[model samples]
Target: MNDKKLELECLRLISDGSGIGYINGIATFVTGLLPGETGVVAVYEAKKKWQRARLQSIIKSSPERIIPPCTVFSGCGGCQLQHMTYEETLIWKQRWVEDALSRIGKLKVTVKPTIGMEHPWRYRNKARLHRESTGKLGYFKERSKTLIHFEDCLLISERMNRWIRLTEEFLTKGYPEIHTLTFRENDKGEGLLLLEGVPTKALSEEENPDLFEALSREGLRSVWGSDSEGNLVLIWGEEMFNQTILDMPFDVSPLSFLQVNSKQTDVLYAHVLAEAALTRAETVWDLYSGIGTLTLALAREAKKVTGIEENPYAVEDAIQNAAKNNAIGHVEFLKGKVESRMMKIEEQPDVVVLDPPRAGMHPEVVKRLLELKPQRIIYVSCDPGTLGRDLRLLSQGGYRVESVQPVDMFPWTQHVETVVCLNRKHS
Candidate 1:
């Protein structure tokens, strides 16, 4: 233990696996280890508290280890389980949610098997690439500022991969210093790329005419401007082709908080709606409603739906989307935090749908929901840790979890989305 550079062999990957190895009695996170594999990890930094290490070499390889499909697998920090087998990856993700609920939520409940994607690869409908000063476009390194240049990303759709290649060609042809690129795929399979950068003094509309022309040739719908104030403005497009609809139609702006996986979002929304079981007489309240996706969906079945959101822009967009869908009469937009605004509502809803952020519901908000005491509650969560914690609190206040279903929103990733339906326990 007193050795300056101790070499420890990594045996297997544990639950908190991110390819980070562990040194016995050192408690340091080291990378480059697979389950049942043996690798010598060199401990460089150590304290009376803990130790850190880097993998020197792989002494033995695990049978479960497979060659990563992405060339930039280790360099690009976008994916952690690229080296893991698909079946193993799914098992670990399901265990992660179950463990979070048992340890964090401290409740006894059944966590059903995860619903995985049919084709795990090419499931990502959107991707964000960082452009460095050297004109290299890729993802950032793990826990570092270094950019790992990549020609193709395995997680995104094939169309997005093509767009990256096309953008790289554009950059080589005297395009300005681009900072970031956001790709979004519509339901029709067309893509829109939003480029952000500071324009050079000599650059002009005439000089960039060919850039738009090239984008059009590649079948890209449009290209937007990352303006001086860091705002996204439309530079060129058909205007009509610039829109994207999730559950409702919204003028897809660069800053809007749309779901990254477009295909999975449709599935996610459908599951959420089914769990809510909205009826003609039921009035539903949707908390943390972003752009009225779930609100609009629920409005179709319920008599009325009131959506609460914090972002002013998103609330405005939600109202516009409601009007666009002709559901304005059925859905009302309330702009504010759930805890504060719930107290002032004139009427209590029959059912409440809570889809809070990763941090989960505020304790006060949970308490207020119990006070309001809706007949049923459907909780949709991206973070299992927070969801489990909130479920424990809800269970104590006369709510019993009817069912919990896990959805694979992010394929080939550790993230899992769960929808929990809770009904008031009858006497």
Candidate 2:
């Protein structure tokens, strides 16, 4: 591809943290360029309406831009917006939510300023690293398969960093079979390892004792691996990984999903509970409830709470979690697709809580909600673009947008978590 060089001035940042500049009515996207910055870029790929360019030289810079401290910040896909100040990033996240609501949903509503952490670094409790062919472990380059190793990832705790080093050193010896490593940590810094490839050697106490011994010595409570059939089996240690969220205990399996940021999950769930405002007489439904975290919380106030989930593993965990939390009597866990299980729910719900996946709600789910017509709906969303589209549908179906709160769950990244509350117009 022939490169065309052009001097561009970035007007704003896009959803992916890339700077967008307009030239001759066509948008040009250049990585590593911040808003209010002018840089000469090499336009490599040009389309009829847009172009992708590479930053060459910065002729001007934004006041909020700062030098990122991460060693692999320029190439690694783990974190974005590291070059911008944290305070400014929070402001932009709020604006992003406002933009999505107005431009996509066509709703003119006030969005509260983003809630940020006092100390944002080292807050992540989970990390997934890809293994290269030679057994080296690291994250991939942005939008590329090229693996880039990091000396130290600032997102996770120091304890996890040590575990990664130990595991990498052990695997580099000859374990070409393992291709991915996932680390999950609890609030106490206890770690769990999940290896996602078949091992040439059996990882048992009798066969390879050193690997487990070293990891166990370093505070790893368990090790799990996927079989050839893709089912997770406990290779060693405890069967379940334990985590405490908002004073409630949870048993998480490798296949289950939990929030990556431990501290912000508390903040996010507290906001959800506050917005729910459930009473003893009210009934609530938690759709897409994973491991029953929010469902159990709602059970404390609601007369009865039902959690609908499709993943059988997550449903099993949620059932056990309800028992562990002593809310088994008030909470019910249904194992099936939410869009299908919702049709069978006999009890009328006073409030409905939705924490759907990043792809957002299915159209049928939205239509069902419109039919059910719950008095109050509290939606927890991770993607703003999808949230806006669903909100537009719900608003058209007779729900008024009450409030939208954006939480900085993943700081130094382009992602955010938002909680929205809506009320039926008749109510």
Candidate 3:
């Protein structure tokens, strides 16, 4: 009857199952909306084809709604499901994976309950903070180029939070522009912030003598260089403090691609090992094995393990890690693309563990793997869309999906890491 009531009906949430709000045939994703709940959405921008709306008022709240722990839950864009209860979040995520597989991949495999973290909050061991000219340090807004500043992040480790506070103080000293700051947590829980950038004209040696001293006080390591051509030189500290390096446990470099969540990585690795079902006489191939995390694990079970990676630094680190762990004799590192280098292997592995990037495996890589036809293929994917596509191709080559388990390596976000076990039809 009134203008406000008329606007409410225009945006009806047909299904709020996957954090997506369907309004007038267009999917409008909102944070707090739940299924069967009614809300007044404010339309900010409208086009002839579709409309975008924000929740104005919750006329009815779903039972799934819960109190958000973080004060900046909505604005931070760090955690997507913080508003929803943890139990509800897990249920929805499982359903999301099942729906994606059935609808997108056309597969009928069972989707197991999501493997949740014991401690969900502050699980991230790494945080990449972007710096703007305005002294604001935080993540970029979703779909926007602007940055949203924050003092502390609930998702980062406690040591990283301390570093963020100290870095904020350092930035207030009228230093030059800093493009990005990557924070890493060692096994000892010590935090290191790698500040990357060239010394702009605004930054002078005499102006900020406290930069290095402050970093030392905060126990933060500094690495200076342009984004394109600069080495990660450890200033004021050793290269690694806790985790293994080359073959011994040590700290990883800022440029290295270690798992963001340190605690859950052990669990994820165990799952991959179980899926592989390695034997002592069989060889194993770890594809895209960064820093030999999976390669080292595989060597413990298999007779021998060969890891292939494109990055020479990662391959070198993997070699060092293997030697340090006393697994070097059983493991070897090859630096190259998997599709091209896999052909050089004289013996086919009994198991192949694929942990590709978010883009998933290339078509040629998939073709080669299917041709090799290993006894078991363990696909660890970060993106469900590409994972599903690749799974379909593997299925075409007679590899049946045996089991699919979703691991919540990253909590609060829509991103899910899944490990699928596939076996050859005849094997």
Candidate 2 lDDT score relative to the true structure: 0.90
lDDT of 3: 0.73
lDDT of 1 by residue, 1-427 (tens): 4335545555444344544444555566566576566666767677776666766777787777778899988776667777778777777677777887889888778888777777787777677788765566777787787888877787876777777876766676554467778777666666777776643323333667775576666677766666566565666664433334454565555555667776777778888888888768898999998778788888889999999988775787788778888896879999888788877887888899988999999888898888988999999998888998999999999899888888887765667888889999886
TM-score: the better of candidates 2 and 3: 2
Whole-model lDDT per candidate: 0.75, 0.90, 0.73
What TM-score does each of the candidates earn? 0.87, 0.97, 0.89
Backbone clashes (count) for model 2: 0
Model 1 residue 329 CA deviation (Å) reads 1.0
Candidate 3 residue lDDT tens string, 1-427? 1233212332222222233455666655544567666777765656566555666778877777788887776676667777777776776677777876787788999989989987788888788888777566788766676687776687886667877776767776555556787777765566665667643333333556676566556665443333445455444445554463223373355666888877678778888888887768888889998888878878878899899998766877777777778886779999998878887888887889999998889888888887788889999988777888888889888899999998888887777788999999984
**CA lDDT, candidate 2, residue 235:** 77
Across 1-427, the per-residue lDDT of candidate 2 in tens digits comes to 6777789999998888889998788999988899899999998888999999999999998999999999899888678889999999999899899999999999989999999999999998888888987778898787788898987999988889989998888877876778888999998778998888753235676666887788888899988887666688787788878889889999998878888888889999999999999878889999999999989988988899999999888999999999999997889999999999999887788999999999999999999999999999999999999999999999999999999999999999999899999999974
lDDT (0-100) at residue 396 of candidate 3? Answer: 82
Find the candidate with the highest lDDT and give its number.
2
Mark the 10 consecutive residues where model 3 has the least summed lDDT: 6-15
